[model samples]
Target chain A: MASALARTTYNVFFRRSSNYLVGIFAGAFAFEIAFDSAADRLWDMANKGRQWKDIRSKYIQAADSEPADDEE
Target chain B: MFTRAAYTTATRAAFRAPTFAQARNASTQAANGAFGADRKAAAAWFAKAAAGSAILGYGISNYVVTDDRLAPVTKAVAESMTALQKKAAEYGIEMPFTVAHAFSTADHGLHPPHYPWDHFKPWKTYDHASIRRGFQVYKEVCSACHSMEYIHYRNLVGVSHTESEAKELAAEYEYEDGPNDKGEMFMRPGKLTDPMPSPYPNEEAARAANGGAYPPDLSCIARARHGEEDYIFALLLGYCDPPAGVNVREGLHYNPYFPGGAIAMARAIYDEVVEYEDGTPNNASQLAKDVSTFLSWASYPEHDERKKMGLKTLAISAMLLGLSVWWKRFKWSYIKTRKIVYKPGKFDEV
Candidate 1:
């Protein structure tokens, strides 16, 4: 009975350890894909001339004038 | 002790390799191969490892860390974008642009560039030529946009004039809504009741006039920028072709001494933009010096008096503190030296 119990424990440990390794690899791959997507979005906004108008014209006009003194 | 020895032996057994000589020989062979046919492969593996690590690092750090990795890049991008703006500015370009202040309403954002404190050379009094030039810039250039909302007429005495002279200068402007005959509200001369006016009547009018660019009120710009008198002085002079190899994008012009080096204001001063009454050339540097001085004075009109009072208070406090320390030391010494002679066991014998 004790021998059978030891065999069962060994089998359970081996199965779980193999699954953990597989899970680690899958998790890493999923994380990489997500990271790539986010990086692409950031790159588009930053370097690729996404909204030149918002960055350039609006504030220059505001700087030349004055902000609204009236507050809500 | 037996268990510890067994554990150590087991760990060593797991780590044991072949004979030392064989291991060394194998390692040498491996090194030779590594330098030869395996070099490219090894380098590729290293590159792959680095790339993988960077991706992982980016994921973990970006999620966990609040610090921005792209600040310098963001700053560069903002500066570059400014050149595309077509606002009517005194700078050479005429393009304009707009965005909400990159800084949040709760935060004033980044520090503007300025001359290092170590670079400062102190002057004894107002440089008259600079002062005259400053007065001109103040009256013409800055007066059009900003309000010196806190300054009182009584504060202008020391910058360019005596008290009586300041009063004469003060007499030029009048105040509104003063005390009535019944000690209620009425109108009066521009005594202490009035602050400086906004260049525009109101925000809508200001925006309409400037093509939607809101010129910041000058009232506290000097203070807000953490300027020394010379900092303002340097910034005005520092405006030029954004320093060599320095890239200013879109609407931003680079002035190295400007708190941010990307002051949105068109470089307003130029060589001979305004003819100085004192026969000084109205060069950008000279105008900058003058305007900086005038702005400083305008920001803290009674600055000289306040500085003097502060110095006097400091000196008095130092003297008092020194006297107190000396007295305490003398008292302590006297107490220590004056040993009370007494018999140890005779309580009532004295």
Candidate 2:
């Protein structure tokens, strides 16, 4: 069973060296995307109430209710 | 005939085939044709073998990296790294880490506790109402000793007071003006342009009045100190009896929050020290909180605008991040998914 699995793996990924190179490049690209998104999510969770997203609604409501001032 | 015979003999000697003995002797000489008769073919074969080995190495590496058998190992490593990062964030361990200064038991004072100020969060702005009350506190209490030399009466407009109100507040104080026609200085009512007036003319006068301990300017005190607003709030109410075996001088008061467990400025804020115009409680803690917030605003006048800009920046960055991620994937999809198949005889025919 191990020999058969190895033969299949070689045929799929290593028969041509270009196939292996392409697979590595694709895997790295996918990993980068996954890691970036996961890190972003973790950061958002950790700083839940401190971020602007958490208070944006309240800020908008306050702004809408109050008369606009001339001051920048 | 004699010259021709000598020339022929010399040519024969120079071009003669090696004898058996000479060939054996020349065996140790370097070979001239190390690459053999077809050097190009030998080099091409070596290049092909090197390329094949390199491809084999890349294939082995790719297989090892993507192996499902090592998933748990990779997962554990990633988890541990993230946990360490989380711990660092929790402890506020900034880069170029240094140990916190240790206080000696002989004279070290108490460390102030962190207060949850309304504006403590990155997205939060100063409580304007509290700032207005803080201004009242400063005007009534701290201004007697400390000068806000960097603050002008006009700065109050649209922040804590209206234009007319700021003008009126400025008019309450008197400032010395330039020489008159008689070359004598004259006094004029303060204007919007004038800085907040100091209680004393100079540092020496201030020191003489306050028993050699001149009150520092409060304009930048919030930022100058280690604890900022938290230290100010604690110091205002930190006064207490000295612990056992400690001696406070005649002029100095014992405040555990102040460094060395003693401060020249005595307990300034007390219950009902100043009445608030908005009918907020006149307790000592509330007074301390308001004044600390005011001082924080004094130190960072751009606090609200900075937070607002931060929110805008974060929002824009989030949008750009999403768009760039999508754009990158879209651009790479065709190259990543396309398959190339070879027809053996077609290239030869071409």
Candidate 3:
């Protein structure tokens, strides 16, 4: 049953040489994007509050409020 | 039967004649021309298809299916993958995924907790205001014992101080200068060119003043230490009374963040130790943080510039990668799309 499914898959995607080449290129592109994003997400999670992205909003808010306080 | 034999001989003789050979060559040339035209047409079609597909893929991905729209789907996929890995690990299966531990818990002292430093991010610049305050903390507090030998007053200009401010700060100290007209060394007011003056003239003096424990230079303390800025910040506030059964040597302070848990330099920063010119909080932790930042800047003056270069490299590489991908597809299209037919019987007949 697995062999039959594998044969069908090969025929659908790999039988044509052009289809095989395109699949390889597209797969590589997708893998690079996926891996990079995954690793970045994991790093961001590990350093949860230590990254600039985590604190940028609060920093901007504080800066915004400071002028108001000075005016008061 | 005789006439048929004569006709066969004539036909065989015609096959070896120059005119017959010329006709064969003409037909072969015609066939080659047709094949060439077919290949040219195929190549044009392939080029068009490749360019159209690339444009369509880029357009669809950029406008129709944008990153923000796909973010949730990508996040869900990542979460599921992580969950699957965790489940596998629970069943004594080893997944080929590992993250380096950020905080180390060694046999010596506790690892410093990670703090969200603004400058730690690749694209983020140092909080110049904080750095300025940190310089104050270093000047008023740390410089009493530790010497920043590698740092010059001029180095502070444009980073934590203005040129005039740095010059004024430099002038506060006195430096030994060469003899002018006399063969003797004389003391001169400090200049921007002079390195930060040592508290003691030499290491021996430093050790003698601090009871035989030499104070390390503060110039590269951030890099020299195990935990970098985190360790420095923690060591400043990590001072506590010796635990039960632990005998700290006389004149040594106990800071858990330090290796061996016994530091020679006593707690330097305290609440309101040095008042910030910018009216920043004067708490112990704040002072520690500022000093750590200042020392970090001293150790790595080009931190911001390095990150900026990294951002530039990534941006340029991404564009080049897209161009290269398109070029590769275009170059490979002809070879990849071409079809080969097997005509074994025809070749055998020829």
For all candidates in order, state the fraction of native interface contacts they contain: 0.00, 0.02, 0.00
Identify the superior model by lDDT, candidate 2 or candidate 3.
Answer: 2
Runs with alpha carbons beyond 4 Å of true place in candidate 1: A1-72, B1-132, B152-154, B162-197, B228-264, B279-281, B340-350
**Positional deviation of B308 in candidate 1, in angstroms?**
1.7
* Candidate 1 per-residue C-alpha lDDT over A1-72 given as tens digits, one digit per residue, 9 for 90 to 100: 147886675565445878657767887899667755664454334433212222223123333333231100
Candidate 3 residues B1-350, lDDT tens each?
45888878987775443343444444444443443555677578779989999999999999999999999999998888789888998998877773445654423688899988877876566665667788888888888898989999878765665555677788988888988688899998899889988899999999999999999998888889888999888889989997887788998888778878888988888999988865778999898888888889888888866765576568659978988865554544444434588776745545
Angstrom error at residue B90, model 3:
45
Q: Local error of candidate 1 at B66, Å?
A: 29
Candidates 1 and 2 compared: the better one by DockQ is 2
For residues B226-307, could you state the per-residue lDDT of candidate 1 as single tens digits? 5555656655555677557667767766776655466666666667666776566667776776777667656655553454
| Residue pairs whose backbone atoms clash in candidate 3 | none
Per-prediction DockQ: 0.01, 0.03, 0.02
Q: Judging by lDDT, tell me the better candidate of 1 and 2.
A: 2
CA deviation > 4 Å runs, candidate 2: A1-72, B1-102, B105-108, B346-350
Docking class of 3: incorrect
The prediction achieving the highest TM-score against the true structure is 2
What is the TM-score of each predicted model, taking all chains together?
0.43, 0.59, 0.59
Q: Model 1, residue B263: displacement in angstroms?
A: 4.9
